[model samples]
Every structure is written in C-alpha cells, then in structure tokens.
Target: MTKHFKSAFRQEVAELVVDKGYSIREAAEAMGVGKSTVDKWARNLRKERNGEETHDTPISEERRRISALEREVQQLKMEKEIFKKGHSSLDVGLNEKFALIEEMKGSYPIKSLCDAFEIHRSSYRYWEESSKKIRPEDLRTDIEVKAAHELSGGSAGSRTIATLVTSGGYDLSRYRASKSMKRQGLVSCQPPKHNYKPANKANITIKNNLNREFSPISPNQVWCGDVTYLWVGDRWRYLATVLDLYSRKIVGFALSNSPDSALTKKALSNAFKARGKPTGLMFHSDQGCHYTSLLFRQLIWKYQIKQSMSRRGNCWDNAPMERFFRSLKTENMPKNGYKNEALANDSVRDYIYRYYNSVRPHSHNLGLSPNEKEGFYWKASNWLARKG
Candidate 1:
C-alpha cells in the first residue's frame, strides 16, 4: 500500500520544519511521515517562498515574476485602503488600527493587514477580544483628552481640558474630560496651598489707599508691587514685580539676591521710568518690611507717587499681585527651581514679557492677554482723543 496526502496538508506539514524551527526528523516524527518525504517538502516550500523554480513546484520564470508583481499590486492596494481610511497608520493608536483591521478583514488577509500596520498578530488578537466593550468614539475622545492634558504640561483641570479639546474641534465637555482622565489614571499637577499666618503690623502708617479696588480706569493710574522668592544656585533669590492694575500687566520687574527696600525701590523705579514717570500714580503693596522701610518710603516721596499699604496680614487687599505670583509659580516656574541665576532670570523674563504678557489669557481682562488689553485701551483712548 502507498501513502497519499493532499497538497495543502503537505505544505502545512513542511511549514513545521521550514517556516517553524522544527528539524526534518522532528517534523517527520510529529507528522508520522517519512524523513525523506519531509525533507523534500521543506526544500520545495523554501524554493517557493524565495520565488525559485523547483521540480515539484515547476513555476516558470515569467510566471514567477508575474506572481511577484501581482502580490506587490495587492499589497499596494491594501496600503492605499489603510491610508484612505485612517489617513496615516502612525497617527492612530494600536487598538484603533486593530479595529480598522477588523473592519477590513473580509477584504484583505488579517495577517497581512496586521503586518502592514506594523502591529503584532498577538497584539491584534488581544485587542480584538478586549475592544468589543469599548466604543470607538470613546477611544478617540480619550486620545484627544490625553493629548490636551500633555500639551498643558499636565496642569489643566477638567474644565480647561474640555476647552482645549473644543478648541481642537472635538465636542468634549468637562464631564467627559473628567471621565477620560479617571479612566486613563491621569491627574493634573497642582501647586500646594499655602497657610498664611498673621504677622506684625507695619511700623509706618499708610492706610489701604487703593482699598481693594483692583480694576483701575486707565494705564498708570494704579500699580501694585510684590516680592516672591525663587530657589536658584542652591539658595533663595528674590523677584519683585510692578503690575499695572488696569491691564494686569507686569510693567517692571527686578531680580536680586536680597529681598530688601532696594529691590522694591528698583522695581518701582523701573515701572516709573517705563511708564514715562506718570504723576498722581498710586502704588499698592502688602505691609512687608521691604515696602514699609524708611528707604522705600524716601524713594516713594522722591517719585512723588502716593503709597497704599494692604491691611496687616491681609493678602486679599493686594489680591491681584498675589494672583499674578500664583500664576507664575504654578504655570511657568520649574518646581525644583532653576540651576543658576542667569537661567532663572531668562526664564522669568520670557514668562513676563512673552507668555504672561502676550499669550496667557486673563479672566480680569475677559480672556484677553495683558498686552492685548493694554493695546485695546490705548487704541480706544487714541480714538477718543482724536475725536475730541
């Protein structure tokens, strides 16, 4: 009696040795075939895979080339379909690509599609099983939410993330943002709240002249000043800023190793010179020793500017300045601080002049940046002056 086998069965058995790592003897033992028979099958399969003609394969040169061309055309067609549907394979997530593969599986081979998308077959199979419970729209929204969160340096909360997603043309709400964040285990980075304690009263008497009136009528009418400490070069450095309350703009700033009357005076002097020494200006600040010192008071009198002091230990009296510092520390400044004074100065300068003044949206300015608000005010003032 002679043994017989189908071509498909023979090819599959031979693949155990050729495509898989089985030896000829091992494959023959496993499949209950003769060792010589297994060797011949493996040889023929190798030749076929390499497009070479064999006695049993019997494929002509032209036929082999035509088959190769046909396979190339099929691959191109599949790639074109993927690009048409997904735009770019790299732009989508692995699970999303697997979903696409499932959608087009009837049109093309699953293994070929997985290979084209650069995804492993095992990963696709796993995703196929797990993706059944997840909606495609939810997956897309999660991706958008993650992207928006990263773009905000992980500082955006649910509301801000929702706004960012909407700006990117996605219809995401705060609820969805929160849900996605929870699903992705993403938590926004937030600065710690400070516990301010009551301090001694000011040595010199200056009433709350601005009296918590934050919004001024015009530029140079009222300016507020404050000092904050930054860690640089393994020590504390001080930053003093003068803000025009009308536009919430940092008109002047100074950085120094000392937090004294000189630092505050220099900041104020810079603001006065920058604003062309406008008269009848009121400068408001907290009752810190730097602001109440005799040296600082002498400079205030020299500039002939009115001084207003916040109520002792009351931060809300100078709330705008406090808010500005909070934004700077939370949004821009590095948590571990800068490596050197020069780097710190540069970072502060860019944050003040570029991002804070020109780009960041301010609620007080009705979402306009500081520079934009000031520009609008100047434009209106000029128009009114010209009309008069």
Candidate 2:
C-alpha cells in the first residue's frame, strides 16, 4: 500500500468518498474489483499521487442464475416445437400421446416438461388410480319404486317390488334396489302393522291347491282375495278384496271399521253382484280363519263356489292376489300414520279401483292392466272361435 496523493485521480477518489459519501466498500461496489483491491489502489494513489482503476463492478450471483434459467426456457421452447412437428406428420402415435397427456392433465399432474409434450405422466410415474367411484343417484329406480308403491298404495314391502324389478329384466338386484330405496326414503306399504298371521294356517295347511295359479279363461272362473288396513280418520279401517281371476279385475272390494268376516263377506257380496256367479268357479285365499269360519263355508256352499286355501305363510300359493295387496299398500298408504281415516279411505279408493285396476301397466299381463288383459284375451278367443 502507498502513501498520500494530492493529485487529480486521488482527489477524484477523495471527492467520491467525501462528496458522493462512498466508503471503500461502496467504491468497490461501483468499480469491478474486490474491496481490498480498491483499497490497495486508493492507498497507492495517495502515495504516488495519481491514476484511476477503470474496472467495472462484479456480476451479481442472482443475475447469473436468471440468465441460466432463460437459456433453459429457450432450449425447451425449441424442443417442444420439434416434438409438435414430429407428431404433425405421423398421425396415430403422437395423437395418442397428446390425448393421454390431456386426459392426465385433467386428472393427474404433469410431472415433467417431457410429460407436457411427449409422454404421459401416468406412464412414467407409479401412480394409483382409485376404484371407488360413487354410483350416481338414478331417478329411474326412484320412479320404478314410486310406481310400485303407488300401485300398492304404499302397503307392499320391498320384497315384492324387488321381484318385479328383477323379473322385468332391468340390470339391477332387488337387494340393491331395496338399499337404494331405503336410502332415498322410499316407503313400503304392505303388511299393515296389526293383522294376525293366518289362523293355524300351518296346522290346517292345505296343498297349495291354488299353486299360485291366478289366470282365468272367463270372467267368473276364478276370484282372488286379500285383506289390508287403512287409516280412517282416527282409527284403522280394513279393506277386503275379491278379484275376478279371469280378468284379474277387482270384482269386489269392501272397506270396514275392521278386518273381520263381515268385511270379507261384504267384499264377496259386492263381487258376486259385480260378476254374476258362474258354476264351478274357484275362490282362493290364504288359510286365514275368517275364510274357514262357518259363515264363510256356508256362503261358499250356498253359492256353489269352490274353496281353495294357500299353504301357511306361503304368499306365492296365490301370488297374483298377494301381489295385489302389496301393490295397494305401497301405492296409497301414508308412511307416518294416516292423519285421518277419511283421507286414507279416499286415497285407497282412488288407487285400487282407479289406478291399479285400470291405469298402471302390469308387466305380467303383457303389460296390460287386468281389465285390458281380460278384454284382449276374450276378444282374441271369440275371434278365433268365430273363424273355426
């Protein structure tokens, strides 16, 4: 290091340190040398009395890093253009890659720059694809269930409708349908809470003499019957039904204060008048004591009607009739208790005589309502006979 300088260069440096308020460090920053070098030059200037160090400031580390990044970006831009062109000429392979990338971008992250243009991130990385996709809520099942419930007046249980849905060839399981239904809060109306199981039905168990056979060739050939309850105003009102097997039509129906012999009798009486008794006709029902009661047996004998009973707890013995009661409850009964008996009565009446008997399509009867099924068959048979 040198001594003092009273000359121009030293004076200029002194002016910078004094007037510009630059320290030896700041001067080193303004110049291109280390602070020590600048200090050595300043000492020498002070001794020899002249000369400036014309070196520029040192490059910053951050600036160098930014420059390297820019170079990489430019290289990638060129590479992307090349890949895009390469794919432009060859149709299949490149399109497939691009499509794969697009699909993965929406689903998974593009792990690298190569993944953006040339390859799929999914192909490179060991990524897991979750299989638990939630099944969507379908109104079709809802509509089907509601239709069944409406047909039965909300009294039919999930089991019967499950049978219908499965038998109808829909790609669904009744178990699944039942679960979905419960989830959706759809209600089953069959099996009113009260009502005893058929009386000593097992002890007296007759042959499924009915064999669940419900089809009839003529209007008065067969009659099917069942019992269900309705919420009447404040108490329960029970309904007894007699369906003409030939048409599967509601030949007789009676709603009474309770489920008793009188209720069944009224229904039978209405049915008798509705379809004038034909000889050798069959009357089938579950082995309920009401049907076996003296009054019922006497009426059957009086009318020359054949009495048939289903085996105990065996609903399919007279499936068509059992199916009917299921339809009525599901279609009409209010789930929470009927607010008023009169309202329940009105709803049940509308469903049975109006909807189930006439409007809703029954898949078994060639998708025709009972009346339509019978009428069509009669027309066909009559036509065939006339031709013969």
Candidate 3:
C-alpha cells in the first residue's frame, strides 16, 4: 500500500531541506516521506523564489508559495498602518521613527518594523532604553528653556536662559539648561565683537571724581549716563540713558535725532525730575562733546550735582551705561533697526520700562531684575528704619 501525507506536512519537510539546510534524506526520514518527494517539492520552491516559471509544481510547493503571498499582504497592511500614523516617508526624524516603533512594538515584530523603517534594530533598541530613562522634569526644563529663549527675542544664551528659568521657580542650573538647549537645537543670536582703543590721559580739566565707582549705597546717589546711536528710517537717532548705580536701573532715557548737549541735558532733567530732584547726586559720563559741552555744564551746576567725566576715549569710566546699552541692542532691539523715529522711541521705551527694568534678569543685580532689586532694597531700608 502507498503512503499518503498532507500538503502542509510535505511543505514542512521540503522547507527543512530548502530553508533549514537539512539534507533531503534527513528531511524525508524526519517527515516519513520519500526522498524523491522531498526533492521534487524543494526544486519547485527554489524555482518560484528565483523568479523562474515552473510547470507541474507539486501541491506542497503551491502551498508554500501561498504562504509567502500571505506574508507579503500582511507586510503591506502594516506599512499602510504606519503611513496612517503620519510616518509615510523615511524623511521623518530618527526620534520620531523610534517613537513610532515603540508605539507599534506590541502589534508588530520589532525586527519587521525596523526593516520597514530602514533602521537598524540595535538603534531602535538603544533609543527605546534611553527614552525610558528620561524624566518628565527634564522635558519640562526643555520647554522652559525654549520659552525663555523666545522671550529674549532669541538672543539670550544658556546662562541667561537658565537664570530666567530659575527665577521662575524652576531651580534649573546653567549646565542643565545648556544641555536642554543643545538637545532642542536652540541657538542664540550673538552680537559682533567690539574693540576698544587704549585710554589716553584726562584731556579736559574735569577730574574723574566718580573714578569708576559704579556701586553706591543708595539710588539717586550715583548715576551714569551714555549715548548710543539707533538707525531710524534714513537717519541715525541718538538715545541717552541715565542709570542708577545702586540698582542698574534706567531711571531716565531720551531719544533724539542729534547727539547734542540738549539731548544729554534732557536725559539728565528727566532723571532729576523722576527721582524727585534728589540732592547730593553725582553724574558720571564719558568725555563725549555732548557731556562736556558748556550748556550741559550749566544744567549740572543748576541741579547742584557733581559732574564726573570718563578719561578721554575711555568707556570703562561709565561701564554701567555701556553695558545697559549693549543689553538693549542685543536683547530686544531689532537687528535692522526701527522704521521711524516714533517707532524707535516706542521700542526703546518698552525695552527700558517694560522688559529691561521689570522683567530681564540682570547679573549685576544677582539675577534679580532692576525693579525687584530696588524693591528688596526699599523693603530692607524701611524695616531697618522702623527697627532703629
């Protein structure tokens, strides 16, 4: 009597010889089939895989071919599902691909998903492990760093951003903030480097009485002033600022089309009035013609304020004012400048009053804003006076 076997069993026997590298005699013995039958099935399957037309394919080989077709259909369905999840193209970021793989790992084989995404299995595994280790707090820090950078008009560096985030009650360190920025691909806009010339002797008769004594015991006791140029429309506009040495605050500022003594006097007048015309104030500024002009001299004497000038061609004598202007231009002012004088005035006003004094973190103030620093000072002073 002849022995009979199922087509599935025959294909299994053939696959043992064709795919599992088993000898034909071994496969036939293992499946209880004849060696000649195993040989015929293996040959037909090989022909199908090699794209050769083969007539008289055994039933076992046909079943193997149908299994291959079904696998291909399943792969197509998986790819369609991936596309529907917004990962249709390989142009997606590696992180995104890794995330998608993780999401579908339970539904599909990781190796198959990796092959479909054209990524190495090892890379997906590494990403999966690294993702598991990321804490939620680190993600929040990244978001805060990005927000602080944007708040500074994309000009603040990691240190500044870290200070801003910390001030917002996060306690983020500069190094950690820097790492977050790097991970998020956030880069700060930097200003051009400035070269200063060697300082010469005091040419004018006015002594350097302030002598770079930037720090004072109280607001209105010492003030520094300087002028910077801003491009407004077709002409350059000058901005003069008066900074209180006690708090790095811009007590008063004036914008003008000319860098004349009138501009400096107006800035001084604004400061004097704003501070309730306080007495015994000393004003320090560079030896610019505007500050040294006779008209500006009379205004200072009228206010009974001692006038001090930086050494000729020396900016350090009035360092606080220079730093304030540098911060203004780099942090908030537009790169190409304002469209008109009115707009320039408004922008400068907003930066000095709304952002610089009230919001920005000043290193001189030990990470406190100008307003915050002054508020603390007054609170302490009032408490001390009451205690006294």
TM-score of each predicted structure versus truth: 0.57, 0.51, 0.67
Which residue runs of candidate 3 sit more than 4 Å off their true CA positions? 1-134, 192-195
Q: Residues 128-216, candidate 1, lDDT per residue (tens digit)?
A: 78655778888998999899777655666787677667756889988989979987888877567777774545425798889889988
Per-residue lDDT for 1-388 in model 3, tens only? 9877777776677689889999989988887778898898889777776767656534455555776797899998887777676446768888778878888888888887898788999998888788668689888998999999988878788888999999898999999998898788998876676888859678457889998877798888999899999988988999999999999999998888899999999999999999899999999888899988889999999999998888887887777888888888887778788899888888889888988888888888898899999999999999999999
- Decoy 3 TM-score against native: 0.67
Lowest lDDT sum, 10 consecutive residues, model 3, at 55-64
Best by lDDT: 3
lDDT of each: 0.84, 0.64, 0.85
Clashing pairs in 3: none
Q: Candidate 1: deviation at residue 385, Å?
A: 2.0
Candidate 3 has an lDDT of 0.85
Model 1 superposed RMSD (Cα): 15.4
In Å, residue 245's CA in model 2 sits off its true spot by 3.4
